[model samples]
Target: MVYQLIKLLPIKHLPTLLGIAAVLTSALVAPSAQAQTKTHEGWYQVEMIVVARKDDTGQEHWPSNIKLRYPGDWVELKDPNATEVPNTTNNSASATATAPVVDLTKEAFYLLPASERQLNTQAQKLQRNPRFEVLFHNAWRQVITNKKESKAILINGGQTFGQHQALEGSIRLSVATYLELQTNLWLAQFDVNVGQEITQTWPEIPLRPNYTAATINNLSLDSEVEAELEQALANENPQWSNGNFDANAAAPEANNYVTRQIILLQQERDMRTSEVHYIDHPALNVIIQVTPYPSVATTPLPTAQ
Candidate 1:
């Protein structure tokens, strides 16, 4: 009777038995609760293309169009139509030549008249403009958190305290030096030369060690950090030849450097105090109240009854 019952049981039950055995095996192979986060899992690739320019004060202007892509995230490239050329390294004859940085290696320096004219034409267009422009659009902006709004005051006339007063509104004052293209054009030249070196070094510094994006103000810092950065940049990209780049150049060059340093210092300070979002956004643009102090009116009102 037992042999007859076994024969009646279907042979297909063997596969079902194997499936149950596999489930039990997997259950036994599961991991424990002691695992930690791995660094390889944390590494995210982000890219920014910086186009450097000089301001009136000869400070470096790093305007970039950045794009970032993560395995699970989406990124919108600033220039969707921008061309992509694959780098080839296999053949010596076909090896691509690195284009020399024309802006830096160009024979004539900023002091030359032709360089001044080129910079002035561009600087004038940037100044007195209050529009917001996008630098990069990606999930990175959500991560890095740089300030999008400008903090610097924009000079505009408004009525306050029963008289006309200068209102302090916000504008896209060059993150670079403020140069009047006409009389003080040389100031712009000085910024270009020195700024080039500074911008290059800025990326080298691990601005954020912990993550792909970091807030510089949040970290504990030395008082000399600003001065050190400025000096390092000056030494790397000297304005003039000889052992004395500062001494050889005119007073305006030094002045421009000093002023630009001040602006940069202020920017650093603002990054700490103000709501700065550093992600992919390039320009510092924010709307601030230009509260004009009440103007003092000499015109006396008739005696009140």
Candidate 2:
């Protein structure tokens, strides 16, 4: 009877068992194969624009040809003509003289191929970036009413009503025709609190603010300040300033040295921002915050034309 039962089972079960084993083996190996295949290529370039509001109110608009490149392949963007300095100011006096050179070129990047170009086009053509409605405020009203919790007569019952307010803003860029290619949306809001380093709540590394070399004055420091600064300088580097020189008397010399060093750094930053390197193709409109990384703390802003 046992032999008969074994024969009835036959060899067909072996193939089924083998098939199940094969499937389990494939499942175990597939994830590693996928992981081995995935890698990120280096950053790419695309085109972008800097659209600023022209009027005091957010109504009227004017389009200027600003040329910028971003990451990845995207829509072809045209470079605008050169820019001119509109205004220049100085502490001593205001002059309409030669405007300081401000390179407006910034490197923009994007994914190689966006999922949908139509959406991108629609956003640009409509002069509005895609945005989500954010309910920031809720309004409420209260009415006087009374209801007896005890066995006494229930005086009254009231209901409260409320509404939500949504905050929305549009992107502005004018062209000859009332058309756009796509919308670039920035849904996130970042609170940037600018204050002195000592009073900040969050841990922050000191960063130099944006300013031109000429902005810093070349005048000498006061007697007391100069004396302290001279001492500090001597402690750090004896060769930077002569220790024997009278602090009050050498105020002019100390001031000139400090001022020139600052100016040099400012100029260096400006030069880096101004340098333009070209690639064979354009990139897509990838958005990255302009905030500098810790390592690049002192790097100049990208020239975003």
Best by lDDT: 1
Error of model 2, residue 72, in angstroms: 24
Residue range 216-283, candidate 1, lDDT tens digits: 33222132432333455466667532433332222222223311121111122111111111211112
Regions of candidate 1 where Cα sits further than 4 Å from its true position: 1-86, 97-305
Candidate 2 to truth, TM: 0.15
What TM-scores do the predictions have? 0.16, 0.15
Worst 10-residue lDDT window for candidate 2 reads 259-268
List, residue by residue over 1-305, the lDDT tens digit for candidate 2: 22232355436333322322232232212121122222121111222222211121122121222221121222212122233464545544555555534222232211213331212332243244222111111111111011111011001001100110011111111111111112322111112112213321221111112211332243344544445555555665566565464434332321122100000000000001111111000111111111111121232322222
Instruction: Name the Cα RMSD for model 1.
Output: 31.6
How accurate locally, in lDDT, is each candidate? 0.22, 0.22
